[model samples]
Target: MNTKTIKSVRLSFLLVGMAFLLNSCFNSAKKTETTEEKAKVYPSDVIPIMEQFSILCGDGTSFKDLIKKEHKDFFYVTNDGVTDWVVYKTPNSGITSRTSSNTRTELGQTETWTPEEGGKLTGTLKVQHVSTSGDARVAASYSVVVGQIHGKEGHENEPLKIFYKKFPGHKKGSVFWNYEINTAGDDNSGRWDFSTAVWGYDMSVVGTSPDTYPAEPEEGIALGEEFSYEINVYEGIMYLTFKSKGHETKTFTKNLLKSDFSTKEAIPQQIWDLYAAIGRDGVERENAYAGEIQNFKQGAYNQTNGKNPEENIVWYTGSETYNGDIEKQYANGCYAEVWFKDASIGPGSAPNKQ
Candidate 1:
């Protein structure tokens, strides 16, 4: 309690008060910055689909943390001066997910189900662009897969690959759905796709050469057009319904538990015509994708890329690549763009027999 001791105590209190004041100012500044950031809304913020599924944005980034923020080269929001749409844009020749060679910026359903214990998935989207630099002879060239029903077990085959494709000289694009048959035996090489068209020729239809063009599909879809699909898997049977504004509404039913392509004679004529030359006439397993785990995915799954044209002429697109630069690819039409206005997922119900 001496004079010098009292002065020392007062100074210590003053120093402590100054330190606390500075800390408060720093915290306040940080809060203000965070509030400003939160003020800006994003597509995910308005849609909030991340509450159920995990998103893989374009540019190979996962939307686990920054779901509310837009990534310029990937997932973002855009309005056509009327309604907002979530755009999923991915380069045809850029970084992709670990499990896939093809680039995809999509939302994967966290849950998995089986054919007997069925599930449902649906998507309403328009493909704005697809790479136009692929080998014309190849079926998958210049195509983009918009939705998928990917199998998680037993060969990991994709049961459904919904595609939109337009060749170099075509005015309209074809919309088709392919079903990859589960191999009948240990040789996975026997797998093949049975594609059926919604509004145009199936995936089997292709030009005769890399530059030659086929006759335009009279009923095909065009760019900027909107379409929808419903995958109602009830009681192990897949009931598909597809609809568009000015196109015919199509409905299909397929048995997932049994193989329709078990014999050569059972193979569809389209498959024989498309795959016979490529040596891919394969039969499905007797017990097709019976007990395998499956899940749903929705987005722009860019099927075209920088793979060599001579490698696999069937699936390799041979798209333009500016040494793997994404910006350049986007400018040269080496990307896939899709916008979804509305989407949903839940239990599937019985299909109405029309």
Candidate 2:
């Protein structure tokens, strides 16, 4: 071959070798960059971003703005400078998120992304319902999870799972059965005095009075010895049901508003009657004998001492007869009593005297 042609061929071969070496170096650098990028995307880094993104979206913010405003803290740029991811740390809850690009084609196209930990981003949040008047408060926690990506537009799947837990507040009072029944005359002439120390005050028979009466003790009606009482703190409703010895039943309901001792009323009728007739004499009086009046009178006197005299009286006077076969149903009386603090009563007078 000619010298000129040979020289040209040698230069071409040298240039080709240089181009191959440069290409190899470029591929190696790219591989190294990919490895570093993968390492940066750990479960910790991705979890937080996902969580913030979810919260922002749930709060009605758009995905794009959510990242900018709420997830700014968790973002990190990829080694290639073309991709980013975000992280979030939920407060008293679990983690979650959304991504700027979740599709194969768009995955690395965005300046920022979320939920790098992969799998499904999931977590929980707590919410509270606080009463404006400081009378009540309730709290609940909810859990949620993000599933697969939707279409190429990068929309996320609907929350795949959810659950909730309720937290109840402490009750603020003591409940007592405050009435007595007189089997001797089948009369329900007494009062029950219940009180609670709550809302920075004492509520009891000494404070206010609610009135209730028992239905006439029905003949052949068996008395149910056991009864149930339910108090709803939220609604402030008290429910009482009495089962007679012969299976007869009676129920009464009272609103805390009307029965609260914060008012000036005497004891509620139900409570007054209960307190009057619940003792040994009230329950076991079979014969009309001497000294009974004194006992009854003394019982009444003891009820009214110094606290609140108006709440100590039992007003029913009646009688009924039942067949001996079944524990006789004494019907003919119904009474109730409720008491509330006067708002004027100082906190010092609220303790039990006994």
Candidate 3:
């Protein structure tokens, strides 16, 4: 071997080393890209408090482990160019809870407490869309429930249901809350809900004809308008506070242990008008939701259904469900969508302390 041969061998060794180094660097870069692509943003990532709750998708899928989990097209997180929002979306018709005919993509609190042992839930959200294919004469049509305090026992009635509703072709919608009575006897068929307005008209305001609409509320909330609500159930009393920019702040109080509609005469004229068509004039129990286990639910609980409104006026929205086909319902504007930028759940606070 001469000096030239030794130089040639040395040069080959250097070239091989360079090639190996470049290959290794390329592989490392590819691995990092793969990992980044696999990463996903979940609702629980946006809202850490979601770990304390379980989720029910509009397709009737239930999930107890929500940490870092998401259901596509139902419960997920998205950015609106300014802020990340957790979206809750559901169609007009889908597989619903056995107890309900309507569908929802909502979170149910894992912990349960009685009215006396209270709880508090808060959310800063906006309504994006509502079912646009329901009869205007139906009260529950074109509405979505944003938050609820649902009874776990007894008639399993909802003590509170916060709603956002808009009639088709209307730019502004109404924000309201309803309290369903715990019926006195086993016949739950006579159960009814009484509504109170928060920003616009209450649930009782509806069109005379299926396609007609009432006068647009002057102080109503429009779609994509931001609003916040705090439900603090403390010491058997529910204290509600609603706030929105450029809108008047409203506060309300109602006792949970005592029945305001225990007698037929105590029933509000609104209830009589809304429920009388269905023969649902039953009085509430003497003790309204007292000692009943209850939990909080937050998200989009779609109120529209496909049933004929003539069968039951208050419910039975007579919307176009497309035979429970979620995709068709969505494409045809028969869906509900809500976005929450902030939310929290914890123990209730005393009225004086709040």
Candidate 4:
């Protein structure tokens, strides 16, 4: 072949080789980028127990992959760049359990326990938002339930309801606990809750109107603040400890085997003042929740709802539900968002020191 023609052919081959090399590098880079994205930690990966439980979303859907994947509008994972959190975001008014008006995007334990054979549940979480609507006089206004020990048998009354409440324009919110009475007789009409303030006012403390504000709590929790709680039902005692930075650590102990409010006279003065407005004077079972099958629920079990507050001031908030449209209610600031960093469930352990 002529020298000039051979040189031209060699140059053409050289160009093709260069082009192939560039294409291979680009493909490798793309593959690496996709791998890194897929390897990113997800909500379920951080929450190890998700595989052991069921999740109920704020939009009224129940699924097992909530933690493993993202629901976008409801359950998902987010990072503050410091820590990862599994968010339980549910609307104030949406489809919920048949027995509850409030909606929740939370985890349900697979196991159940009774007072006689106890179990324990623990979690560390933060509240991001609560319903902004509700009458000030109604106990559930501007509040959300973060955790609970719901009874499964009998009237299915909740033995424990942990709450976070803040009034409008307030700088901080209150953290409190409530004990729902296990009805003494077949009638459940007279049931009442005895609230104990942990860091702020209890459920019984209410304002005079929907807009009227109460005195700011001297010590209250702010949004995005972190708190820890351990509900240890060791033997027959329900030992609870609540801890947070810049706040006093509170501990409480209650007997599940015996009834503290077996009779009307045994009810605390707070009950009389709080429930009298609603005509709730129900007495507790003589044995309280003894032998009752109970299970622990951890997540955003919203306390606020869209029912008329006057109809049932204790739980009905009449918050905007957008006619049960979950996404719309979420957009309208009618939802509860809770994020848990860590949690555990197991057989009851020995009580921890205060």
Candidate 5:
């Protein structure tokens, strides 16, 4: 071939080779970027137990397929400089279940079991925040439910509700649990909850006035403090264990098949004072929660609401909701946030074995 023609052919081949090399490099870089994006962690990666549960958010969002998935601002993963945690957050007021006025970003167990069948749930978590603008006179103000044994049928009363509460400007807060009565009759409005303290006062403690707060708990939990709880229902009895660093480990037990308040005289005086205004004096059934189907719940069940506290002192938390504007409420400290480092659910074991 002629020298000039051969030179032109050589240049063409060189350009073709350069284009091929550039394309290959571009594809390799894109593949590396995709690999980095997929490296982002998720709540499911932290807690593989989510496969057996469904999630409900404060905005009325619900989902069951939680494998490697997360919802923004409600159910997601976060890191606190040391550990990765799954966060559940809810505003004081948002779209909620029909039977509840308060909102929640929580997990509901898909399986149901009777008291006799039993189950167990365990969690390691921390309370990040609670609604700061609530009436101190209200029992449920500035509080959130972290765990629960909730009924699935009949009146659907909760047998256990683990709570964390702190007053505005207080450095420490209280951890308590409540047992709601399964009312005897059809009228459920008269049912009441009996509370027991875990690390501090129970649900009955409240301020004397609307804005005034009581004394801060001397040995209570502070915001961002980590704790753990195990609820084991074995052979018709409920056993609870609460533990935290720098605090005493507390354990409690209650018979689930027998009624503690079957008769009118069995109601504690705290219930009389707390529920007298609302007239909720009904007693629990003789069998209590026996034979009832129940399931476990965990995460931030926000107890603060916008209802007037004077209407119902026990549950009506007159907290600022910003008219259900979640963004405004979160920005103004009118929300609840909880973070869980680990959790698990399974069949209940014997108390001795646990």
Candidate 6:
């Protein structure tokens, strides 16, 4: 053979070898990229995988329910149609894997996940499908964390000390004052008391007849009578006393901490009016007016009364003694009193007549 022919043949062989090597490298790279993308984790896919574990619950048992009952402080739920477990650990604590003996096996294969101090537990569940093709399987997994609970002090059966305040206004034609009582810490059965100064002024000062007033000074002021007073509070209890000429003297003790109290953002106008009207009367009158006032405040006014002004006032009236004229005057005065009371002292301890 000629030298040039030999050289051309050698070049041709080298070019073919180079092309084959390049094609092999390209195919290998493509396969690696496909594998990496498929391996990425997805929580939704994993949770459904964990539900397979629920198969263990077939024997009249629920693994999820059991976990919730055992550790109410720690629980997990998944929306991705997958199963997950989560755990939280306190500092300096460690978790140990539960053994077969530690888990109840009556239902099926189940495990108790534990956490260590400063450690967190997480679970991710997924399912696998076996293909008809021999030895071919598709699988997925999920992640979750476990939680820990701290114990609280006091036994469940221990009695709790309740504290409250009572604001018993004066009876009609009597002085006005506020009295408090505590049923938890001090004399639970003691009556409350205050001084004449705390009782403020007598209803007689306003042209009202004291003869119609309550036998006790704790009663509120009469209609058209207005008074204010301050009651002292020491610790949780209060001591009050009063004396009148030709009348029996009395002393009362009460604790404010034992009174039941709730806080509301606003007091309705009708409630304020009803409270004022009742305050002008005695506890008996107040109790009687409660239902009527509640109905009025709830906007359930009598239709017949709405047609006639006089009937309207009477129908709205909480007391039989209050006529249309008296009700109008009482309502106007009550607006002022209610605002003053609510602003200055807040909702005082008066029983919910309702």
- In model 3, the worst 10-residue window by lDDT is 37-46
Residues 30-145 of candidate 4 have per-residue lDDT tens digits of 99999998887766787787766777777778886545566777777788889898888988777788887778887777778887788877888999988887788888888888
For model 2, the superposed segments whose C-alpha errors exceed 4 Å read: 42-354
> Candidate 1 on 229-344: residue-level lDDT in tens?
98888878888889999888998888989988888789888877777655787788888888889988888888887777576667776777787788988888888898887777
- Evaluated at residue 47, the lDDT of candidate 1 is 65
lDDT string for model 3 (170-272, tens) is: 8899999999999998988888999999988999999999999998888899999999999999999999999999999999999999999999989999988
Which residue pairs clash within candidate 4? 44-67, 190-282
Clashing pairs for predicted structure model 3, backbone only: none
Worst 10 residues of 4 by lDDT: 64-73
Q: Each candidate: what lDDT?
A: 0.82, 0.23, 0.93, 0.84, 0.94, 0.22
Report how far residue 83 has shifted in candidate 1, in Å.
Answer: 0.9
Candidate 2 lDDT by residue in tens digits, 1-354: 999999999999999999999999999999999998666553224333322222222112223322323332222222225323222211211121243211010011112212111121112111111111110110011111111112112122111111111111322211122212112343423212242211111122221122231222222211111122221111222233333243334444433223233222433453443344334222223221111110000000001101122322221111111211111221211111111110010011111220
- After TM-score superposition, the amount by which residue 7's alpha carbon in candidate 4 deviates from its true location, in angstroms, is 19
Q: For model 6, what is the error of residue 226's alpha carbon versus the real structure, in angstroms, after optimal superposition?
A: 65
* Candidate numbers, best TM-score first, in rank order: 5, 3, 4, 1, 2, 6
lDDT: the better of candidates 1 and 4: 4
Ten-residue segment with the worst summed lDDT in candidate 6? 293-302
What TM-score does structure 1 among the candidates reach?
0.86
Minimal lDDT window, size 10, model 5: 309-318
Judge candidate 3 against the unseen true structure and give its global Cα lDDT, from 0 to 1.
Answer: 0.93
Which segments of model 3 are wrong by more than 4 Å? 1-39
Residue-wise C-alpha lDDT for candidate 6, range 120-236, written one tens digit per residue: 111211111100111001000000011111111111010111101111132232332222111122232221211122233321121122112224334332322322222222333
Better of 1 and 5 by lDDT: 5
Candidates in order, TM-scores: namely 0.86, 0.21, 0.93, 0.89, 0.95, 0.17
Q: How far is candidate 3 from the true structure (C-alpha RMSD, Å)?
A: 2.7
| Clash count, predicted structure 4 | 2
